[model samples]
Target: MDEHISEAIGRPDLIRLDDGLLCLRFETMKVVSALAAVSHLLDTGVVRRGDTLVDSSSGIYAYALALACHRYGMRCHIVGSTTVDHTLRTQLDILGAHLEQMPPSSSLKLDQNRRVDRVREILRENPDYHWMRQYHDDVHYLGYEAVAERIHARTGGGSLTLVGGVGSGASTGALTHYLGKRSVDVRLVGVQPYGSVTFGSGHVADPEIIIAGIGSSIPFGNVRHDLYDVLHWLAFDAALAGSVDLLRRHAVFAGLSTGAAYLAARWERREEPGRTVLFVAADTGHRYVDTVFARHQEAARVQDLAPRPVRGTHELTLPWSRMSWDGSPAPEGALLRSAAAGAGPGDGRRASKCQRSRAAGEGATSM
Candidate 1:
């Protein structure tokens, strides 16, 4: 364990969890690991203590940075989006970190780049702020690498396919680097939401994706696209269903992104049976209780759509996209037509209808 993390989480209770699913119990330790990485960067002169650690985070990274700053006595600034959870914002404020909210833009979505731009603007206004630039920071992965090392050790360094969601792409890249150097046999698998364009896909402006902690609008310098042996993009519904399934079946309540990672792992395992497929459950799913777990509300939203069995490499459509793109008013013809016909009950057949409806609109940018 990193010295900074050891101090934060303490030694005896760091890795101990109730059921070994490693959900809520490990959060403090994860935050500690993040702090340790930041401290290491500061100690090595890669980043200075006075430098402002800036990141475009939904919540977790901001929370981590806030705690890390508290430990290192560094000022932390976050470029936050409007879509972030209100509870997370409150916690950040309590941590004494400054938040720069990015105004929504047409061409440039409320993404990491927008946050980066906001950070740049703040720095321009105050020359004293040094952007920590987590996207480009190679040291950010060192702590995550420790996790990979632990996984390898636990798994006996076997040939495994690691599946994980990409936020800054730091964790995936760092794990790939560490595992790759340790052995040439391990495969790295990256998962992203359908609308994310983090990899080489075009930019998406204000995509309505529910899965957090993955899919950035801007690309990270350290992300090794070529290193990934396989890539999978999951739909919001599939990930949502996966999360539900995990809770119902495995009794694991993981976040949507972690659910997406688990789905990808299962999908890969189905294709290549008997293969050791390891996936990281990034966070717990308690944060999404109002969204993903709200049975009645979510059902009402997708009442017009039905579930369908998706085959190989199928596109998943979101309910919001059925309305219109640019969040503009729907076409008069369709609006009038739907009103006249009246939306009917959503059966399994509505899946194809939803797919066709979204297909007519602009396709999502890949990440």
Candidate 2:
């Protein structure tokens, strides 16, 4: 039996959607990463039970971190993104995680930058607080080791193609990293929103919102660009079509990111007829009911939709675009931009004399 609700919620269900296509669905995906990261930090003496763990999150990671803190008797203080809705705010409040959400902004970059700046400010004020840099730190990848083991056991070490959002790089990157060690021939396909800087799509802006929890406007240090074999950029309308068709055809009610992955996975399956293709459904469709599912009537036919094949990010176009990355390293252009912006690993750290001065203090009791 699971000792905590975090474990239960972190466990994912592998559902076969077709002869060669599968869906790895999670109710709340990041819980696995958050739990393992917090436990590792505590065990390694980097933090204790009571230290207030602070981080910036859009929505899912806030809830995941809150649950992790609840499991480990830590206090969580989140600098939330503008996308954080009332439902998540209520959950965070009940979970005992203090949230200070940013005012809604017109630009994604501005919103993300504001949150990062806020986290730095919080760290300076509360020097004892540890910033869980989910975008930049690799500790978040540890939890997926066991998850990869489960996937290997079920899939029987065959040639597999894994498709999912490259958000924070922990989910698809960590899973493929561990599975590769077990001799699984896995091809990683990452799905991105049009405006995400992670995969050179920052130059193109989608009129609609960038799908939350999957893509980012700022550079994420942990995104191992070499781990990805192909890339797909989907606009909101394209993702909506995929999501609507997924519910209509397969009865799987998943979020917009899942819909985008579903579309990419189907294409990969067609390209590699013998390989088993599995896509990650990071969360359920409930949060997207109004923004996505409610507008199902306008959703295009998934059968009629196809990605515009591109040679490079420069060639990326419109509603949907696909490029064969071939396991290449991070683009030189992206690296230069990151260096100029100074947004890589160790960016979130704020040194202070009071660091670890109260390691023995008792932490907040778990909810």
Q: Which candidate is the best by TM-score?
A: 2
- Backbone clashes in candidate 2 total 1
User: In candidate 2, which residue pairs get closer than 3 Å at backbone N, Cα or C atoms, i.e. clash?
Assistant: 50-363
Give the Cα error of residue 238 in candidate 1, in Å.
Answer: 0.6
Worst 10 residues of 2 by lDDT: 349-358
Determine which window of 10 residues in candidate 1 has minimal summed lDDT: 352-361
- Return the TM-score for each candidate structure: 0.70, 0.91
Q: Tens digit of lDDT per residue, candidate 1, span 66-94?
A: 87887787888877766556787787788
Backbone clash pairs for candidate 1 read: 198-367, 199-367
Model 1 CA deviation exceeding 4 Å by range? 1-33, 46-51, 103-108, 111-113, 200-210, 296-367
Output the lDDT of residue 301, model 1. 25
lDDT of candidate 2 over 48-76, digit per residue (tens): 98999988888888999999999999999
